[model samples]
Target: MAESTQQKLVCSRAKAKSDTGSSVTQSSSAPKRKASTALPLDMKVRCVSSIPVGPLVYTSRRMQGMIIEWDEFGSEQYIELAELQSMRNSSPAFFENNWILIDDEEVLHFLHADKYYGSAKSIDDLYGILKKHPNHIAQLVKTLPDHLKKTLSIVAYREYTAGRIDSIGVIKAVERATGLSILSN
Candidate 1:
């Protein structure tokens, strides 16, 4: 019975992976990344939701650079080649034909390109980028460095809710409170 149950669990996980075509998994033998202390779920959500996602890399004479310019909406966003794939996965509608940029003033702009430019196709694709790939949003967050911890702590402290409990982490709570995400955008 126990063997059968174990097999079932394995099958379920495999099925899940197959369904999404997501093969990325945290490396068991690899070193663990540091984790920040617990903050309000809403605060963490803000970190994810506040992220301004977009970028495409172009090659020059044996070099590559991604543009960091203002987008159609006027936000100071950025999009690198890899991150664009992730951005598309997270919000296919937002990133599909389009690109996002951020101006010096930190506003988001979105624009559609004439053709598809990257290979991200699902939410899992975006998650993989953020969770594992280079120059991804999560990578950017992790790159913010120790000095910013104080700034982050201050931001986290400020992002916490003063009202009733919502730490249980239901989708409804996310929708009802933050609306579109952690910071109301």
Candidate 2:
């Protein structure tokens, strides 16, 4: 929107008597008093390092995961506590005596399963593998076969539509099917 160049002036007093018995008036363009504001107003805050403690939420937006841990200086750290604990239990050698300090960007990448999930480049690549699996139906069928590939496809479609599936979900599905942790390849 374009702004207007003209401004209206506001006068505090209509007229004032001068010492010489002459009337004077002061015209001001700016307001004489400060504007009043509502107290205890609700506002939306965008915080990088702070998030409410709860279950991780999955979304299709660029921020695929919505779980952040904050530090003293308001610095953000993304840590999937549940996943980390499970991973520690499964692979004690990897977690034992480890400080658990990881970069926020890396945590986001790990959440999306984009950087370190097996030999695949992305979740889509894993989907492609499932698509070309030997057991996959080449043509539409009234009843899909009870195969791993078919189940994966169904789960993928359902989760994608529900805004739950992303690169991370895809890798996690693969891990669940094969009993492996996929935070890192």
Candidate 3:
């Protein structure tokens, strides 16, 4: 009787092993998983100031600290997102003057310069305003004197005749006319 019981136990163990093996085979025949097609959340930014306050590397990767790169001395440091926010809050002017965020598509979104430039009564005042907020060039250009606007029109016409009219060229013309270094570059 004991021998018969032992044989029955062995047979049940074999049946269980076969069941597990069949499940393993089924799993092996299953389709493979597809690769991820998501974009990364990494970002790159530059300090647009004459005196860059932070690191020499201006990139931030996912799960990594943002690198702040200073242009003046070519120094760089890795800082957390919270720390970067702290720096910006602590020195708003420095942050705004230096690190204006450009979108991933390289588009610049600036605040309306009306309130800032409206107070200027003369070209000198406009120059001073631009000296403080260089990012306001586009909106402020509309508020320029009629003669200066005509000059800019002439410059734009020249560019149009040349088969290419980029905003940078117009801005350069503005700098030449106004004698203000609106762009850090």
The Cα local distance difference test for each model comes to 0.33, 0.34, 0.43
Q: 116 in model 2: Cα distance from truth in Å? A: 7.0
Query: How good is model 3 by TM-score?
Result: 0.25
lDDT of 3 by residue, 17-89 (tens): 9999999998888785443233322323322222223333444433257455555422233344344444444
Which ten residues in a row are the worst by lDDT in model 1?
A: 41-50
> In candidate 2, what are the lDDT values of residues 119-153, reduced to their tens digit?
22223433454344333323221122223233345
Model 2 alpha-carbon miss at residue 147, Å? 18
TM-score to true structure, per model: 0.17, 0.19, 0.25
Best by TM-score: 3
Residue-wise lDDT of candidate 1 within 1-185, one digit each (tens)? 99999999999999998765644443344685444333322211100121223433222222245333343222333333334434444455443332332121111112122123232222223223323322233333343323222223223323345332233233223223222334343
RMSD each, Å: 20.5, 20.9, 17.6
Worst 10 residues of 2 by lDDT: 43-52
lDDT of 3: 0.43
Task: Arrange candidates by lDDT, descending.
Answer: 3, 2, 1
